[model samples]
Target: MFKLITELKWSPDGCRVETIPKGEHEDLPERAVEIAIQLSILDQSTGGPNTGQQPEQPEQPEQPEQPEQPEQPEQPEQPEQPEQPEQPEQPEQPEQPSKKVKK
Candidate 1:
């Protein structure tokens, strides 16, 4: 893959100049990239691939199977707790009169 060092003004057919941005030109033709490299417009890329896809990872080793755990014995049902008695209501207090503040 070739990486563009600067903006490329290329005219493949001598008709019009196509402005290519400064970046990887993996989508472009290899020959065009080579010409760009010769003109100091591009450089070789250090990426894995230009296919726009991720590389496949190596297969992982299978792990050893774990032994089956023994079933736990069923627990006995707990006895229900008796309901507690309700508390007596407290007597209501009388409201105090508000004092007038002096300016």
Candidate 2:
């Protein structure tokens, strides 16, 4: 919430305040301003003229709820290896014929 503007002038007999913030006008202070002028006209007829900002509520606030986790179990399958037997091939031996004795 932001919006303020308290200005008044008339010094000499009494009155010369200043608050500033909304829009700002500045001239320095009036010295002691404030003898009560309907509370500065009820702060300028309440809201709207501030123009300094502050006023836009719609709706926001809601988020809290999270807790749930439990489920995990599945892994088992491995077994297959058995097949090897083949060996038969051996036959090659025949070479002997050489005789010569005559001198």
Candidate 3:
């Protein structure tokens, strides 16, 4: 029976690392395809697939138009007041009234 093993290959810049086989190069492509399919399934189950997709919207019922209210009429202004009537003004009363003595 033939066995396959994979190893990581780092670039000289160290910015990227890729998976490579230790011996068999031809099997790497097949393994990569399988891994990609598994990742896609995982993404769909976890709702990650819809992260960039538009959200599903619920259907809204149509609303009826509301009737507009009528504006109120402006009120008329009152005439200006004339000179006040002359009243018979009385003298101011003292704080205490004088008491009458009994004989």
CA lDDT of every candidate: 0.64, 0.38, 0.43
Candidate 3 lDDT for residue 11 = 39
How many pairs of residues collide in model 1? 0
Write the number of the candidate with greater TM-score, choosing between 2 and 3: 3
Task: Indicate which candidate wins on TM-score.
Answer: 1
- Candidate 1 per-residue lDDT over residues 1-103, each given as its tens digit: 5577887777677697788888765576544554565676755444524334432443344699999999999999987765985578888877776787878
Candidate 2, clashing residue pairs? Answer: 15-33, 16-33
Misplaced by over 4 Å in model 2 are 4-60, 75-103
RMSD from true fold, candidate 2 = 21.9
What TM-score does prediction 1 earn?
0.38
Q: Clash pairs of candidate 3?
A: none
Per-residue lDDT over 24-89 for candidate 3, one digit per residue giving the tens place of the 0 to 100 score: 332234334334333332122333333444435433445887888898888788676668965889
In TM-score terms, candidate 3 sits at 0.18
lDDT (10s digit) by residue, model 2, range 1-103? 2222444433453465344444323222322212222244223333333334432442243467676666667667756545654456667666666677778
In order, what is each prediction's RMSD in angstroms?
19.6, 21.9, 20.6
Worst 10 residues of 1 by lDDT: 50-59
In candidate 1, stretches whose alpha carbon ends up further than 4 angstroms from where it belongs are 45-103
Q: What is the Cα-based lDDT of residue 19 in candidate 1?
A: 81
lDDT of 3: 0.43
